[model samples]
Target: MRRNWAARLRHVTIDGLRAVVLENERLRVTVVPGKGGDVVEFLHKPTDTDFVWLSPQGLRDPRDHLQGAADDVAQFIDHYEGGWQEIFPSGGAPSEYRGARLAQHGEVSGLPWEYDVVVDSEQEVAVRLRVRTRRLPYRLEKTFRLRSGTAALEIEGRATNDADLPLHAMWGQHIVYGAPFLRPGARIRLPEGVQVIPHETAINPPARRVRAGGPWRWPLVPADGGGQSDLSVVQEPGSPSDIVYLTGFDEGWYEILTDVGMRVEWDATLLPYLWMWQELGASTGYPWWGRAYTVGLEPFSSMPTDGLAAAVANGTALVLEPHETKVLRLRAEVLA
Candidate 1:
């Protein structure tokens, strides 16, 4: 027998920013329009816990969103309010491709997105958010839907190129998880036969664990201390920050079981590659200052986070013909 649960959708303002709140028996999601239509809050009703990480800098008003930083990375960190963001056309550091300079994390994550309520009912709620890139001749649209009595979210997106020239791009979902729900003893499960590759640059401390540019099997990783650390289990806060990429997945899915048994499952078919970003309070830089202890399980269309130019050079970038459109489907489900 199925239980009837109260489901509703409402529009509200958070800190002077337009937001849409969708709630049901199992989940509550807050979508902010001004902040690149990012999902700032994803709360599981059963445990009253939020899976999304809120940056220490916190959310800022669109008016205060900074621009003209010395570089794109600086610009991105200045306005980033950790949660779930869509990176389009490029990822990683700023680079030039086809006469256009791409910024770190891309333009869509920082641009204002137009949203519309597609459906609002007692059984289900859906919304569509769309944005057009100012520097590129492309338009992106994403539709987020949630149904009653389920702890799952369905995301469908489409990217269309309007120009006559082909476009080389990288698309990724920056889904970050923070404390309380993400703690030590948490385990990650992925498809069989997956290979983990470490980043080339030694930007943070954890990079010292695996041989740079070397490929290792998933979960059991050789640490720099001459021992192995189960990469599947989450470490305590204040650990070193590391970045790695996962490939050779037999299937497109990964699951994370928290310390308390809360499970998060992600579909990887749409995105394919998983980028693991570990920021366990190791970043002592200007933005983090060693205060953030979060992990990003990002699914990307390409390898290497060195921006679009690198992706293209490595022949891993996705190319779209003139007037061509690509559609991607992703789902996130929680089990308590």
Candidate 2:
């Protein structure tokens, strides 16, 4: 138990940022000092279980690791790794170069992401995070600005092609939300897309649209929320592990409304594509058969590599010249 957990656990406070805990029934985030105060845990706890911490834990070994679920966030993108850009050219395979050498998502996001917080004239706290890699010529900067009444994330940087030859890549924001925020009665809101694969296998190549039913809707998982179900939660309630995608984001934004009315609106002008990830009991470690416990609302720059490759082959990958710099902006606000 915390010494004064009640008053202390309201909004996130920076007590030298040693080990601060912030709780709000549905969302509880703790910032711990690790590899430079960059490790934080965003947990969704209900009355049913404890120690069911989430957001993402750390790595077991840098060389060897597992796939998706909670592990996905850590291994794929650590807050510690690179700066300006998240680079993993040859996938998660180990390499020989230092700054250029990295795994899956990149080096910056895979490790503790260090940042400098600016407490400004109005008392708002802002953190600037950067991921850069030598082998890959580009940088990803995600700025998170938080005040008492508002929280905003701004990304306006460059993923420049440093290689003499053009480089292909995809940028994404994988917002993994945990329980009480995700429950049996909770629902996932999105535009419209019929097919989606389990988060476990999404990182792998299927070269297809995944197994699903219907044209506008499908079952999120099988009937019992166990085993595999091409289940679609377009409008109905969804399991914790339900996954969905939206293609009609020509509007470029969507809202994830919970049962209790806690709405998480995603603005994706810069990231037009959104990938919905719902994994119920699946995060319980291995053999994700019937476990439904969490969800991932991922906003990505491009489709899967296969899709991007298809675009290139068919002539549609986003192309930028040396002086061309495109700025992408997305905003999400929790209404009062």
Leading candidate by TM-score:
1
For model 1, how does the per-residue alpha-carbon lDDT over 1-336 read when each residue is reduced to its tens digit?
222456678788887778888788989999888888889998998898798889988877544625743466766777788998999989888988878888887788888889998987778889999999988899999998999998888888899999998988899989898866888767777666666776863122132223222233233232343434456777776665677887665456767766333333444554667898888875687878988988888889887888888888877788999999999887788868
Error of 1 at 150 (Å): 0.6
lDDT of 2 at 104: 48
lDDT for each of the candidates?
Answer: 0.78, 0.41
For all candidates, the clash counts are 0, 49
- Scored by lDDT, the top model is 1
- For the record, the alpha-carbon RMSD of candidate 2 to the native fold, in angstroms, is 8.3
Q: Estimate each model's TM-score.
A: 0.88, 0.58
Please list the residue runs of candidate 2 whose C-alpha ends up more than 4 Å from where it truly belongs after superposition. Answer: 1-102, 112-114, 151-158, 162-165, 191-216, 219-244, 259-269, 282-292, 305-320
